[model samples]
Target: MKSILATILSIALFGGFNDIATVNELKNRAKKAYNSGDYEKALGHYIMLTDSLGVKDENITLNLANTYYKLNDTTAAINNYSNVLSSKDRSIKTVAHQQLGIINNKNKKFEEALSHFKESLKADPTNEESRYNYELLKKILEEQKKQQDQNKDQQNKDQNKDQQKNKDQEQNKDQEQNKDKQNEDQQQEDQKNKEGEQKDEKEKGEQEKKKEQGEEDEQKKEQKPEEQEGKPEEEKPANQDPSFSEKLKEMNISEEKAKMILEAMKNNEIQYYQQNKRKAKKKKDPDKPDW
Candidate 1:
C-alpha cells in the first residue's frame, strides 16, 4: 500500500512540471519565429497562446499587436495595441501609444496621430522618434498650403495679360477704319472740283461763238445801201419831145430834109456833151490848192 501512494504522488508532480515546460516551450518557439521574420508562424503561435492563457495577458497582447503591424494589418494592430494601453505596466503603455501614433500618421490622420504622440510623450517624455515625426508632419502641411497660393496668383496674372492684348487689338482696328474713311472723302472732293472746271470751260466756248456771229451780221447790213447809191439812171426817148417837132414846122422845110437836119442836130449835141464831160473829169480845177 505504501509503494502505490508514492507512485501516485510522483505522477501528479511530474504532470504539473510537464504542463509548465510545454507553456515555456511554446513561448520560446513563438519568439524564435518572430526573430526569423516568419510573421505568419509567429502570429499563429501567439493566437494559440493567448487563447489558452487568456486575452488579459499584457505581454502576449503587445507581441500580437507587433506581429499584426508587421503584416500591415492596421485594424488588428490598432485593436491589440488599444488593449495593451489598459496594462498596469508604464513601459508597455508608452510603447502602445507610440505604435498607435505611427499607424495613424501613415493613414494621414494628423490630428489623431498628434494626439497619440502627445499621450506617448506624457507617459515617457524621452521618446525621440515620436517627437521628430510630429514636427515633420507640421512642416509638410504648411508647404502644401503655400504652393497652392502661388498657383492661384499666377493664374490671375495670365488673365490680365490676355485682356490687355484684346483691348489693344480693338483700338488698332478702329484707327484703320477711320483712316480708310478719310481717304474716301478726299477722293470725292477732288472729283467734284474737276467736274466744275470742265463745266466753266464749256460755257466760255459757247459765248465766244455767239459774239463772232453778231459781228458778221453788222458788216452785211452796212454794205447794202452803198451798192445802191453807185448805180446809173435810165435815159428818156428823144422822139417824145414837143419842142423838136415845132421847130421842124417853123423852118417850112420838106419832110425828108427836116428829118435829116434833126438827125444831124442830135448827133452834134451827143458829141458835144460827151466832149465836155471828159474835159471836166480829166481837168484838175485851177482854183484847188496843191497839198
Candidate 2:
C-alpha cells in the first residue's frame, strides 16, 4: 500500500519547474494524433506522459484509456478508467465512474458495470447518460418479468375458454337430442289420435248398417194388409202424406199442432187457408166464436 501511494504521489508531483506545461504540450499532441486517427502514435505520446514524465492527470488517464479503447484492449481501458474513478479528484469522479461502467459493460462484466453505474449516480444523480442506462437496465428486467406473467395469464385464459367452449358444446348437444326426442313423441301422439278417430268412424258405420237391417226385419214381421190399411185414410192426405209428419217429428219439434201448422204453412194453398181462418176468428163475436 505504501509503494502504491509513493508511486501515485510520484506521478502527481513530478521533476522540473516546466513539467506540467511540457506534459500539457504532449497531451495536446496526443489529442491531435488521436483526432487524426493515428491511435498508435497517440498511445505512444500518452504512455510517455503517464510513465516517463510521471504525470498521472485524470485527462491523461482518460487519453490513455481512449488509446487502449481504440486498440480494442477493453480490459486495459476498463482498468485505467477504474483507476481514474478511485482518485481523490472529486471534479472528474462522475465522468470517470460513468466511463468505467461503459467499459465494464463493453467487456461483458454486467455486475461490475452495474456497480460502477450505481457509483456514478451516487456521485452525480443528475447525470443523464448514467441515469438513462440505469433506468434502461431496470426497465429491461421489468419487461422480462411482465412478459413472463403475460404469457402465463394468456395460457390460463386459453385453458378456461377451451373448458367453457367444451361445456357449452355438451349442453347444446344435449338440448338438441332432447328436442329431437320431444318431436318424435309428438309425432307418435298425433298418429295415435288419428288411428283412434278412424276406428270410431268405422264403429259408427257398422252400428248404422245393423240398425237398417233390424228395421227391415221389423217391417217384414209386421206386414198385415188390414194393419197397413188402418194406418192410411185420415192419417194421410190427398195432396200431402203421413210421411211428412214423421219427417216433422225427426226435426225435434215438441208440439204436434205446431209441427202440423209449420208443415201447412209450407204449402201456398194451406197458408191461404190458415190466414182465412184467423181472419174469420177475428170477425166472430167473442161470446159466439165457433170452435
Candidate 3:
C-alpha cells in the first residue's frame, strides 16, 4: 500500500510538469515561426498555446495577435489584440493598440486607425512610431487640399489668358486691315494724279506744235514780194536838172547788191557786220559799188 501511494503521487507530479513543458515547447515553436515570417504556422501554434494549452497566458495571446496581423487577417488580429487589451497589462496594451492602428490603416479604416493611435499615445506618450504615422497622415490630408486649390487657380488663370489673347488678336487683325485699305486708297490717288499730269502734258505738246507751224507760215508770207500779178515796165527819160534823186540813187546802191543783201538776211545765215557794211557802202555810192 505504501509503494502504490508513492507511485500515484510521482505520476501526478510528472503529469503537471509535462503539461507545463508542452506549453513552453508550443510557445517556443510559435516564436520561432513568427521570427521566420511564417505567420500562418506561427498563428496556429500561438492559438493552440493560448486557447488549449492554457487560458491564463497573456503573453501567448499577444503573440497570437501579432501573428494574425502578419498574416494580413486584420479582423482576427483586432479580436486577439482586444483580448490583450482586456488583460490590463500596460506594455502589452500599448503594443497591441499600436499594432491595431497599423492594421486598421492597412484596411482603409482611417478613423478607427486614428483612434487606436491616439489611445496608444495616451498609454505611452513617448511612442515615436505612433506619433510619426499620425502626423504624416495629417500632413498628407492637408497637402491634398492645398494641391486641389492650386489646380483650380491655375485653370482659371489659363482661361483668362486665352480670352485676352483672342481679344488682342482680333484687334490686331482689324488694325492691319485698316492699314491695308489706307495704303490701297493712297495708291489709287497717286494713279489718278499721274494720269491727269500725262493728259495735261499731251495737250500742251499739241498746242506748241500748232504755234510753231503758224509762225513758220507767217515768216514765209513776209518773205514773198508784193509785186502785182500782171504788170509792165515803162521807159523813163534822163534827168536834166539832177537835183532830185530816186530812192536807190540817194543811197548810191546798186540793184544787184541790194538784192543779194536781202536774200542773205532772209536766209538767216548772215553772221558778221562786214556783210552789212558792204550793203551800206553799195547803197551810199552806187557808181563805185561792186555787185
lDDT of 2 by residue, 1-291 (tens): 343344335445666424666666677777888999988878877877777777758878877887898898878887787777766665467777877777767777666777777888888888889888777766765787799999999999999999999999999999999999999999999999999999999999999999999999899788965445433233334227656656657976555666477566556554665666567557666787578
Rank ordering of all candidates by lDDT, starting from the highest:
2, 1, 3
The stretch of ten residues in a row with the least summed lDDT in candidate 1 is 226-235
**Winner by TM-score:** 1
Q: Which stretches of candidate 2 lie over 4 Å from their true place?
A: 1-18, 107-109, 148-291
Candidate 2 vs candidate 3: the lDDT winner is 2
Which parts of model 1 are misplaced by more than 4 Å? 1-38, 49-53, 57-62, 78-125, 170-291
The lDDT per prediction is: 0.74, 0.74, 0.71
Error of 3 at 166 (Å): 22
**What is the TM-score of candidate 2?**
0.43
lDDT string for model 3 (181-266, tens) is 99999999999999999999998999899999999988867762422211223323223335524655788976566666656664
Residue pair clashes in candidate 1: none
TM-score of 3: 0.43
Model 1 Cα lDDT, one tens digit per residue, 10-117: 435657423665456556767888889988877876776676444346887898999999999989999999997867787788789889989998898877887888
Q: If both were scored by TM-score, which would come out higher, candidate 1 or candidate 3?
A: 1
Pairwise lDDT winner, candidates 1 and 3: 1
How far in Å is the alpha carbon of 235 misplaced in model 2?
96
